[model samples]
Target: MAQETAQQAPTTAHTAPARALLPLILPAALVGVVASLVFVGVSTAAEQLQHVLWGPLPDALGVGRYSVLWMFVMLVATGFAVGLVVWKVPGHAGPDPATLGLDARTMPPVVLPGLVLATGLMLAGGPSLGPENPIIAVNVALAVWLGRRFLPRTPGALWPVLAEAATIGALFGTPLAAALVVSEALAGRPMRGRLWDNVFAPLTAGAFGAMTTTLVFHPTFDLGLPTLGHPHWQDLVAALVIASASAVLGMCAVYAFPYIHKAFLGLRHPMLMLPAGGLVLGALAALGGHLTLFKGLSEVGVLARDPEGWSAGQFATMAVVKLAALLVAASCGFRGGRIFPSVFVGTALGLCAHALVPAVQPALGVATGVLGILLAITRQGWVSLFTAAVLVASPAVLALLCIASLPAWLLVTGRPQMQLRDDGTPIR
Candidate 1:
């Protein structure tokens, strides 16, 4: 009876934790809302700055908005400015960005400003990187500092999870992606309760964060591709082939990453490395065209909107060029994320497939391409699958993506990932 009672105690206590977590819903929601607002705030500031630099200033100077010379000038100037921030700012903008990932680390609050500055400059300066890494770091740091000051009773570890989930939720404009990603991450850790129980607060935070971003920003991942109906057996084959091929391409970039970084390291300083990278990027821009610039989201839309405008050769060039640009930007002391640009590379590659084999559906090619490349680049399977499917927004495509991800995942698995440690070794 004693043994049975003791076992029963834990079962009952488990229920208590679940109930205790219910109260956390309020705090979770609050944190989610605030974190999302921070995302919005930072993104808005960057867009405004980008407009000033590329729009009015260029127009006032009588230079074409996307002319090669202007691109060279802006890219060089942005490199120098960001280099100054990294060199002069405390904490060196919180370590080499190549050493970071989607998982957030709490940093001293003072590092946030410099981090934001570098991130903003990179965003506006035509780097083939996204805002995910720094933005997540910023949100996590803020949540940790504020949570410790205001709610001392909360477990010290929860703040990072809450903030990370919230920021990811805000980033994708959907709680589903955040919940899926956080669940994958948490599943690997030792836990005291049911997986769902541990996830409760973080899920709430993701929900509120996604909701806040949706209400405020109205962002959409759906590319409005033509509705995909029932899939054929050939569709499965196409998905597999395209995804596998895209993963192989991403692996090429992964292989080249360390060498690229090593080359930049020879330049020996941020000032020299970034400016040199900017010049190379300008040359790539000339070849890849302006659409290969920036984070690749809107540019991808433009590509999709007018698929007939580009030939297969042009599509292939854009993919290779964008991939190279991403490698350069990430390798050369830039502060940003690679996911968005990788999506563009995948998009172009997928379209190239469609152009080469007219029987391959354009929409399916694009989705599978994104799935494959993201699988390699991020190694976050669920989020990669989600991002790919969301682009097409078809239940049919999701079915295909699930099958597509398998081969792609195998190809990327155990390969050298694109990221490197501070000491320059692969993190794997």
Candidate 2:
């Protein structure tokens, strides 16, 4: 009996090594492939849908002004989408934006279908949320789902971290940023060691996702400048001032968002509330002469590409009206993310700064304002800085923007307001 037992022990130990190796390699590889597929599929689908919808909708509405009837039609369409999400999907149609923080660890599989449907509806109906956040959610959810189905016996900690990181990598367009965000999300958790093993998965997933996205969507990274422009001494000083101001404004927006959303929730009916919000948005858009509506990035591009055409007053008006419209749209239950609106707002603020100080470069001010807002709202200083730098087509501006964002970060961190709770509650 003793010899038999000893023989069984060695056999068991030998099998354990093979089993362990299988779990590590197979599950990790599966996660990478699944996450990459989710990223590519969702990213391609969203962009194609956007182009198809936007092209015909505008022309069909006619070449003239956005009429009240058309505005109402859009409002009803948007409201219907929101109503479907709120009523149909589980977990109340995915994570509440007001409550999301820097944490991007493992989210549930439910987030995948919810995000895809919600994002598709919003984009189709012309609500202003960007596809990037939903893409992240979908990819992460897919990874988690794949991990669960294929590697159920594997250590739970290993698969989730790897899958999430890979999903982030695919969504962010930069694997390094995806890895950093995922690592940061895991910072306080007990699974730090396992997280190290998962790093390679995300990197691979991100590379695959990026390649697929580039092929399908053909996203443009170049903003048409020869390196981020250098900042003059005056431009540097102005950037500091603009960034500081943007930090304060961003905090205000963040704090107010939840309250606004809550207020809309109290309206009791999507049909009524949605049209009301649309009317308000339409009015605001008219106030800004149509430049403030329909996702402001194109307008921002126009401003950036041709700064000479817009005066300081126009920029300031556009900034104020766009901010107000965004607040109303979000508060009234429009399905969208705040990133693009924030970027548009930041660019307008930058243009306003340049108008006030002609000696300061417009590109530098744009970078500074964008970085400041991103720091205050997203708490993602590095990503914001990179975005600002890229948008301005100036490496020197990027450097200065990074430097200026420190004080902006300080201001944001010092605020006592709470943004979100773990269970997806938004605290105003």
> RMSD (Cα, Å) of candidate 1?
2.5
Each prediction's Cα RMSD? 2.5, 7.5
Whole-model Cα lDDT per candidate? 0.89, 0.64
Question: Given candidate 2, what's the lDDT at residue 353?
Answer: 84
lDDT score at residue 169, model 1, on the 0-100 scale: 92
31-124 per-residue lDDT for model 1 (tens digits): 8999899889888888898889989999999999999999999888888998899889887788778778899668999899999989988898
Per-residue CA lDDT of model 2 for 123-150, tens digit only, reads 5554544555555556556656666786
Top candidate (lDDT) = 1
Error of 2 at 357 (Å): 1.8
TM-score of 1: 0.95
TM-score of each: 0.95, 0.80
* Clashing pairs counted in every model: 0, 8
Error of 2 at 19 (Å): 14
